[model samples]
Target: MPIELPFDDEEASTDVDLKTQIIRFILTGAGSAVLDFGLTMLLQYGVGVSGGIAKACGFVLGTTVAYLINRRWTFRAEPSTARFIAVVALYAVTFGVNVGLYSWLSHLWSETVIYSALAFVVAQGVATVINFVVQRAVIFKIR
Candidate 1:
């Protein structure tokens, strides 16, 4: 049975078509990834921060952006404290997976910005898949 929310009766809080949701998720992810990549590059190259540190900061920023958009636009759900905290916990897990993959894969590539971007992309892809599935089925499911 679907869980009920206080605002469930509102049409705005209901799920859209599955394909539409996937498209929105991808679009939202692309925007978030741009922010993440831009911030990481700026901090790593311009500010002299370590790659791992820069990536971590970028991940946090990206995740925050993703959550806000996914909550309102992608998932079309009313905000709940428990759900928000659940997203934080989910991202915390993915952060380790994303950063670890990025860091480990860095050694396999040449020392260039393109190579770094490639590594980040690979890690981000993995995290993205995991995130979408879990968020859609679990965290942000229509109740």
Candidate 2:
């Protein structure tokens, strides 16, 4: 017996398969993470900014990058005000989740780079799941 995929030939040809979208999303996420982490570290260590503020700044910049790449490359969606609004709403929710979780977790651990990075990872992981699910199922769902 052979395993069957959800999409058929025509759909696979015309639409991006789930696997491809996921791969692209991961790649996009990696790039975004680099920017986010870099900025956070730079602000917190280099500029002497507070952890919470640095995290917020990093998250905003990274999220903006992720949204742009995910919209055009990952999901292959056209630009729309409605989609933009939906994304903004989604980001707002994730922003709180990501930053709040990081702040809380960072406080728990010693004020070291390793500990801070760990907190950031935990928060980013949670937010990434929420973002992928909502974006794939709702914001960029295929008609």
Best by lDDT, which number? 2
lDDT (Cα, 0-100) at 4 in candidate 1: 38
**Span of ten consecutive residues with least summed lDDT in model 2:** 5-14
**Residue-level lDDT for 128 in candidate 2:** 96
lDDT tens readout by residue for model 2, 1-143: 22322222332221678999999899999999899999998998899999999999999999998988787778777666787889999999999999999899989998788998999999999999999999998988633
Whole-model lDDT values for every prediction: 0.85, 0.86
The digit string of per-residue lDDT tens for model 1 on 1-143 reads 33333323445564587898899899999999999999989998889888888889999999988888777777887777778788988999999999888888877777579988999999999999999998988988634
- Residue 84 in candidate 1, Cα distance off native in Å: 1.0
Q: How far is 98's C-alpha from truth in model 2 (Å)?
A: 0.4
Candidate 2 achieves a global lDDT of: 0.86
Q: What lDDT does candidate 1 reach at residue 74?
A: 79
TM-score of model number 1: 0.88
